[model samples]
Target chain A: MYKIFLTFILSILLLPYSSTFAVEVDMLIPPSDFQAFDTPNDDGKSVTLRWPSSPSESTEAEYVVYASLRKNGPFTTEVLRINSKTMYEEGSDSNFHYVEIKPGKFFNKDSDVTGGRSSYFFRLVMMSNSENVTVNEIASATPKGNWFNWKKLNNFIILIAFSTLVLWFIEHAKKNPNLYLRKISGLDAIDDALGRATEMGKPVLYVHGLNGMGSISTIAAVNILGRIAIRVAEYDTTLKVSNIDPIVLSVSQEVVKESYLEAGRPDAYVEDNVFMAASEQFPYVAAVSGIMIREKTAANFFMGYFYAESLILAETGASTGAIQIAATDSYTQLPFFITTCDYTLIGEELYAASAYLSREPLLLGSLRAQDIAKGIIITALVVGAALATIGIGFISFIFKAS
Target chain B: MNFFKRTIPLIIAFIMGIMMAFQYYVPHEASQSLLKVVTRWGITIAGFAVFIGAYSLFHLHWNKIKRKVPGWGYSTFVFFGAGITIIFGLYNGGEFFLHDKQEGTMFDWMYFNVQVPAGATMFSILAFFMASAAYRTFRARTSEATILLIAAVIVMLGRVPVGALIWEFLPPIADWIMSVPNMAAKRGILIGVSIGAIATSLRIIFGIERAYLGGGD
Candidate 1:
């Protein structure tokens, strides 16, 4: 009886120890429908993975994502905790879990692995209660370098449509160059300013703002300068062009010389008159200001991209009692120009001045196309505002740029 | 001569223009690498173009001095400044280009003392100019001018501490004007400018606008 009682007690103690070693439940249910694909619109540097959340996942469960260059083994792993309500809500709809893995970061390499050449494999494992379950299949994807990004498809479409419209108008204008463009007050004042300078027998000073040839504003300024140079040649008045960029200085010299030649006054074109004062900002402004004061210029034309120097140059011209005409696309400097200069071209007016002065079919067509585009944009803005007021938000997404 | 001067340049411009425009849409590494190379080449070309500007400056000043122009003395000062700066920069205080300028070097001393002070002095002069410009322009002669003057006053007052002491709502009203009307005008200008720039670029690429090529065909 004593031996029997002892054996029974020993067996009860061993029962609890055996339960600890034994598997509690079948926790090897793999995630379903695993997939990997190249992340779009990238430089072949990343791949995204997706899988249906395992039904076995609970509050205590953790996910471990693995990535490998080869299809099997030697995988680099990253632990992910999806314990919060936000995580569950994010992937709740399709019971989907997604992650983007950069192969370079995965392999701890300095160079990128997904250069559109290498294939990568990924797997997801779910761990709960010390038991783990991994996906049955190793998902693989080869990131490809796309020839074109589809995400910017909307941008491309808009660009193509506008470009085609402009080109069509250009062709039409080439046949008929009598397109109606509204009168811009700032541009109309150009003649008056030039005439004043001619009457005063003082040179007209044109300061090309501090920008290089790459800026459209600078190109517009130069184009306007050509028109002004022709008029100056006809009036037999001197024109001094002060430039801050070397390339623009060279180009302006050529343009002014050509204008003089076209006006049958090639002898009047002085190369020294169109010159670069300085490359640096304040120094250039100082040099130009000094010229404005010393020459006692009767009229000053400030055109192109102006920065902090706008007010300084304009104020000096104002002090000189010159007729100042300023034009720039820079909004910050617009207030300064308006307050100091006599006539100011507000934004697109600067661009329109070129077409207005040149009256070329190509430029006229471009200006007309821009007006149409602006009208469309304004209509869209009004429509978008109305839609939003009515609690329809989808129109905003349609008009979103990039 | 015509082919080399006109036709070849036009062809090159067309090819380059199209390539640059389309390259933005491509997400390929090779295309991006090519863009980098082209950008570097452009910078290199710009570096060489600086010499053209320097020569133009020298020629202008030399002519002025030769003719004994009214400001010929100023031209002499310009030469002196430029010569000294260039000499010191190239000398590098007996060090090579790869090494940094020594602490007591003439280049370092002149850059800190002469160039910096002159630049700062020029910048500081803008404050007085701005005040004078404001005084001349803030006169309320017309209705639009009156409104602009009021807005300017409110903005100036609201930015300082004295504004809050006078009127509590001044700051918020000023903020509203800047955020609403000012912002609206700014956005309108931005959109208009972007479209205009695009149109200009298209005209250039199509070779329909030859003003950049010296106006007349």
Candidate 2:
């Protein structure tokens, strides 16, 4: 026992050293001080880029170099993506992938991004090992200057205006809010669907999507389910909600129980009604779809984020001619839904449906704020454009003269 | 009405959201350091939520087994699968299959034999179902139907090798339809979608959307 304990202590002490691994990558050619001038190519909208590779590189499968206009680029912005090259094939190695920054691929878009005001920076990344792991940071011959667009005045003005509008609307909606969002047809039909299920003595089927938590659509579906559960409880109608995620299943159970208690029909609430169907996607789909067929559900509500399985569930419900109110944020599945379901909440409309159903003041207020923000953006664009066109001289002169 | 139930979680969520949003732009060390702490705490909380979820499942299944419900047999299967999976996973360095017993590994067997086949089957069924659905639904009874039918035919043919074999024009025509008309419609829908998302997010941020807080109307 003492020997074992000593060995454990010694191993624990040596763990950090055993695990310590460092990777260093460097470029050999043109050195760190190489310079390349921005020469106006005959192909007006083009600029050439060349970089050196690391000398003492290990057995790397390939090298990929990335370039951005800024040193620390705002990659989220569309401006930086105009001609972003992800794959830069290495020279001399036919098997190695490389980027040849030539015409048609990354230049000459007839935009205002020419005339030598653009600055570009490049980075070299090494990928080696069987797992295709990326190792060490490598730099290119510093950032270089490139051309710019003179006609970018309009685009700049529009961006400024839109930003202002969104900000203004956000602030305005926070105070003095008078927003009216339209009702969702699918949500409006819920009461009738639930009532029909009650009359027919059949369970109201609810599938709270097959997506994980960070999804806005899943949250919206859960919100709708809460309202539906309250109605079902009040009418003493049997409600079955099948979930793919265990977390979601637990939440659905709580939501159902709370709704029943709120409706003063706690005795009618059944724990088995809300269940975790399965973790695997198709299995969950088969189980839920099978349950719908077996139980002979009168009303089927498919709400939330869904994938290809959306069609299977929706079509199965359609075959039964059940009052199907299917809503999904997955754009690909929308075509299937629009053709099959009685009422379908298209894309963003599905996001707003829960708010409409639950007329909770916050949702209504937020909708109003968003509209206001959009209006503010439009106005800012108009004003910025007018200022930019009338004269950069006038705008700059005003600041300078002051 | 309690502070813990109502105000605290919302306040935390709002603060976290704003902090995360600002962290994208702010480069200060203090902000970055705080962001890391918040992120770690958030991850820990998420881990706890996972445990809670597993516990709920365990509790429910345990009750079913104890009561000897109608689906008690299925409960036994579930219990065995979960128990075996966990045991194998632990033995395989906290993975889902045994390391030493590669062929008989539970995860490899289930994933290959069950998950992959089921997923592939579901995907393959789509092709047959799409054909049947199109045949039944793509009648040119109305102007909309005619348009849809034409678009569907062009899309179906243009995607395959035979369309190029039949007519070179088919490819260009399909490309034009997809790029110009389809793109325009998709863009319009996208703009509307973004607007709705922004509106909804704004509502949530501004405390206008309480439906998520269990404030069911």
Candidate 3:
């Protein structure tokens, strides 16, 4: 009986020591396959470190990543807790990857690393039960500037292909000089609108939209204005252009003046007719609305980028019983313009209108090229979809946009 | 004279356009810094353009008042509003232009109370206009018109809680139309617009489209 009691006491004394041994064993199992590489497609300021989780990884195990300029000693450590649910997984294997940007500042704020490029060494330590074990081999990476980013090589390829097609078509059209373009109804109605205004003896109002000179739609609007101004000059009718941007107003004045000169009616051109109304949104709409009411404009042209003011301007013009023709690239406001305006140029039609009206070889050729590009895109999309459906997704990957 | 007038401008534009386009592909720090510098220059130029616009406005209203044009009284109000706004903006209620506009300042007060309300009023008026336009255009006179009308009704009803109460399937059908047909059309337009925009940009960069340069010359 005394021997049995002594044995039980001895076992209890060794119990704590056995638990400590198990924890030490767990901590000794370090992470494996540690590697580091410079991150691509960025200014040479970041390096990525990756390592497989410790073979004895458990729910309680956490990772601490350390970095050092020199391969030996004085490492700054960053504790990283891996959430089991959110950590990335590849098949049955999971790896811990961390991107260290400007590693000197990131690992240690006091470390001065502003001089030039320097190599960085990384070590990952796995910790559990208040015990830690670091990987044996240190991984190193040096961030260097790359002249070209291979990741965006696909984007460059598409751009080059599209640009080549456009240029080739332009050159071809220049040689041929005979290309057919479909008639757009919105553009066709411009003459009729201007004619109606001339016959009615009422002034025609042309609004170059609320957008400034930077917008593509606004540029298109100005182009169309040039053509319309020439037509107005020919018809000997009054043309009033209301502008919201001062720069656009000045440009419009020059365009209109030039058009008048082209039509040999420079004397008939009124400088003040092409005037800046207001710059603010609602205020500009209000001014244009007042003009429509007061002038009783026979024909109204709303072209370029419009916002909430689209409906306001269109409604006011509609109330005047004017023949309203609108064109915009703004899809959100298309419904409003279609509802209010007599003729509305939808999307690409607005862009094509200037070319269609001018019949300039350059513009026409570019337009044709765009149509071809669209065709190619459609074909690729259909083929890619079919291939993807049949489990051949490599074609889709080839056409993937950045 | 012609060289200075046209050639120089076109050459400048070409160089700038090429540089700007190529800058996008470069990920170097120097390239990014250059882009920032160019953007700052653009902003400065835009500031000058704003001043020119303000001058144009002043000239326009001055002419209106000078001629006693039919609505000369309204022109006076425009000048008054502009003058008051300019004074408040420049003064910034004692902080001047050195510090940002603060709360309780005259500029902030006018902006929040007068400008905000007026802008909101103008925007709200669109609801009535939209209803009127819808009434005229949504008539079921043709097959296409009937389809449009039905779609419109479905979309309008689906947005409200009463729609779900009336028909359990309304919301899902509305979501389907919006997600499928509406999205497809919008994407089509976007693609077309993007292609067109690229074409236009190329045309401008190559100096092929010069109507923007002014018509005759």
Candidate 4:
């Protein structure tokens, strides 16, 4: 009887251990609703997995995802490990979990999809700290591709609308060709500055800031250059165009040449008049500053986009007592131009300067369309603010970038 | 000649611009691949274009030196700088830029010790320029100038410890000025810039603006 009592006590101590090992009590339960499918709006290289809510935060089981090329075979290939507490995040589905399976290299080597659409088999595993584990059944899903990104549909719609507006305006302007544009003070000074340079018998220095042809500011500056070149050619005044970008220099040369030809003064065109000053930023500024000082130009037109070098150029030009007119879309540099130069084109005025100078139907049309678009945007902003204040917040989602 | 110089470029520009613009909305792998291909093409073309810049720079200096023009001595420095940089760069084991450039060479030494410091020095000069500019801007010559000066002083004070020492409300006032008024003005300019950019882009894509392609009808 004593021996039986000792055995009972020993069995009680080992009962928890034996039951855990022998009976195979699962440390974690496989979450329900576990399934896999194709990932949307991707390049066909990813799959997505979904499952029901995690068991409990108190349970220290980690959700391990396994992917296989075949169904019902060795499901040992691991994919991802998700914490149980992650599923309990605020606003997230308290009853559901979803994970995207981007099987890049692993499935490329061991995938089991046949001649049919490419498919992958996936399963969920719940593992505890004690090294005990449980798994859900395998589910198959296909990874697919789509042509258009529906997420960016709003952006696409805006682009189409704006393009149509611009084209329509261009057609209208072509028919009428008498569209009115507001006076840009800096542009107004352009002809006066060129004429002043002629009267003074000193060159007009046109400095294209350190931007390449890709920049819209540089393009606008070059257009303005064309107009200025025409005036320079007509007035029989020397014009100097300094550039930091080789491509811009090439284009400037051609533009100036064409302008001179159009002015019926082709013989007056000089290739050296437009040349690359320097490639590096500070060096370019230094070189142009040196030119301004040495030549003592009568007029200086600082156009295109500028960075910190703006102040240095404008300051040096101011010291030279040149009739300076500045135009740029870089608003940060506007204050410098406004303070030092005789006149400054702020923001959109720089873009509009080309249209205003050329008075071309196509460009003026585009500029007019831009003004209309700005009005629409302002209206949208006011409406959006009112809607948001009134508790309708979905309007903001329309403007959100995907 | 006109066709090669003008029409072909316009056609190519239109096709490329339209393709690139619309490609932003495509999620397919082919669209991405096309972008990569086009980017590589652009880089290659720009690589070839660099020679043009180098040629123009050298030709300008050469003409200056030939003419014995005033300040001709400065033109010689350009040649010296370019020559030294190129020679050392090649010496740094790039196989004349055919292979990877190794470190601990004269090229790296010149770039780190010379170019970097000079560039930094040039940038540092902007502080003095800013001070002078601020002085000019803060002068209360008009009603507008007075308002600007007050705002500048408030912002300057609120940003430092002395501001809190002077007045507790100063910081909040400065914050309001930056967050509300400053942000509003900046956003207005940004909106204008965006719309103007779109207008300019459309003009180029449609071949309406030909000045950038060297001024034509």
Best model per TM-score: 4
Clash pairs detected, candidate 1: none
Tens-digit lDDT track of model 4 for A254-276: 89998898889999998888988
Q: Write the per-residue lDDT of candidate 2 for residues A1-402, one digit (tens) a residue.
A: 999999999999987765543332333121122223333312222334433333323444354445555456422221111111233335544322233342224323343232533444455444444322222332222212223332343443543454445556546645645556666787788888998999999999998777865566777777778778888988888998888776677667877877887788889888877877677778777777877886789999988888888878877777776899988777778888877778888877777676666664445554554456556545644676588887644444322310
User: Per-candidate TM-score, first chain only?
Assistant: 0.78, 0.55, 0.81, 0.82
TM-score of 4: 0.89
lDDT of 4 by residue, B1-217 (tens): 8898788988998999999887887767788899999989867877777888898889989999999999999999999999999998877655566668887788988889998888888888878888887888789999999998999899989989989899998999999999999989889998898888888878878888877655446
| Model 2 ranges with Cα > 4 A deviation | A1-180, A360-362, A371-402, B27-76, B90-107
- Candidate 4 local Cα displacement, residue B16, angstroms: 1.3
lDDT of 4: 0.83
Higher-DockQ candidate among 2 and 3? Answer: 3
- Which runs of model 4 end up more than 4 angstroms from their true locations? A1-30, A52-63, A73-77, A81-101, A107-117, A126-128, A131-139, B93-98
Where does the lowest 10-residue lDDT sum fall in candidate 1 chain A? A80-89
Candidate number with the higher lDDT (1 or 3): 1
Whichever of 1 and 2 has more lDDT, that candidate is 1
In candidate 1, what are the lDDT values of residues B1-217, reduced to their tens digit? Answer: 6587567867887888889899989988888988999889878878888998998898999999999999899999889999988888878888855688666789889988987898899999989998888887778888988899899999988889999889998999899999999999999999999898888778778876666666365
Say which prediction, candidate 2 or candidate 3, comes out ahead on TM-score. Answer: 3
Give the winner by DockQ: 2 or 4.
4
TM-score of chain A of 3: 0.81
How do the residues A190-286 of candidate 1 rate in per-residue lDDT, one tens digit apiece? Answer: 8899899999999999999898988899988887888888888989899999988888998899899888987889999899999889989988988
lDDT, candidate 2, at A99:
35
Question: Which of 1 and 4 is the better model by DockQ?
Answer: 1
